[model samples]
Target: MNATQFKQALTHVNLLDIRTPREWDDFNLGGFHVSLDTLLERIDEISKEKNWVIICYNGTQSLIAMRLLKAKGFTHIDHLEGGLEAYLSL
Candidate 1:
């Protein structure tokens, strides 16, 4: 999605940033914060119904994170289509 679409989605969904700790310290915006490693371990603990929007430095890792969440039966999962770095560019 483009920036406008992403912003609209985040208005209704929980936006997540699943980057490395170091990467996040450099820059992060949004509430849901889970490193990729941690998310892998706690995927099942997240609420299945809450709208979850996974993000990473780029979109690649978020896709992986999204897949992991989906494997846990999270039906309301979403992702920042272009991730945070892309958001910054916008």
Candidate 2:
């Protein structure tokens, strides 16, 4: 979703930050950190009961990650429309 929609619904969804460790250490907007590279291996760590919002540097990676999660049977997966860059700008 776009930043406005994301912010409006943030409180109700599960957030997954899929940025690299270095990127995560640079700054975080809360939620769990699981780099996209290792996401598949750690898929079980995520909860299926809640909607998930994936996050990344520029939204490109997170969009890919969202597709992966959907293919893995996650029904409610979405990525930040423009990732942190856009979100921060908002």
Candidate 3:
């Protein structure tokens, strides 16, 4: 998403980095950092009121994250279309 769109969406949604911790340290995203593997374990700690946007290096991991969240019954999970590439390009 573009910077403007991201900012606008932030009012309703939260960004989530689903990559591994190594990946997170290599390039951190500006929101909640939850590794895909750990997210399921921490589902109860997530806020249902806030929408979630999954992000990763190239969008693949985000898609996986989205599917996983959905399986857990997360109602407002979204993913960056092109992951960080799209955000940085904007």
Question: Which candidate has the highest lDDT of all?
Answer: 2
The whole-model lDDT of each prediction reads 0.78, 0.92, 0.78
Candidates 1 and 3 compared: the better one by lDDT is: 3
Task: Give stretches of model 2 more than 4 Å off.
Answer: none
Candidate 2, 16-80: lDDT as tens digits: 99999999999998898999999999999998777899999899999999999899899988999
What are the runs in model 3 whose C-alpha is more than 4 Å off? 1-12
Better of 1 and 2 by lDDT: 2
Highest-TM-score candidate: 2
- True-vs-predicted CA distance for residue 78, candidate 1, Å: 1.0
Candidate 3: residue pairs that collide: none
Clash totals for all candidate models: 0, 0, 0
Per-residue alpha-carbon lDDT of candidate 1 for residues 1-90, written as tens digits (9 for 90 to 100): 555577667677787788988888888776677888898676656778788778887788988888877877778887776777677776
Write candidate 3's Cα lDDT for 44-77 as tens digits. Answer: 8777777888888778888888888888778877
The candidate, 1 or 3, that scores higher on TM-score is 1
Backbone clashes in candidate 3 total 0
Arranged by TM-score, best first: 2, 1, 3
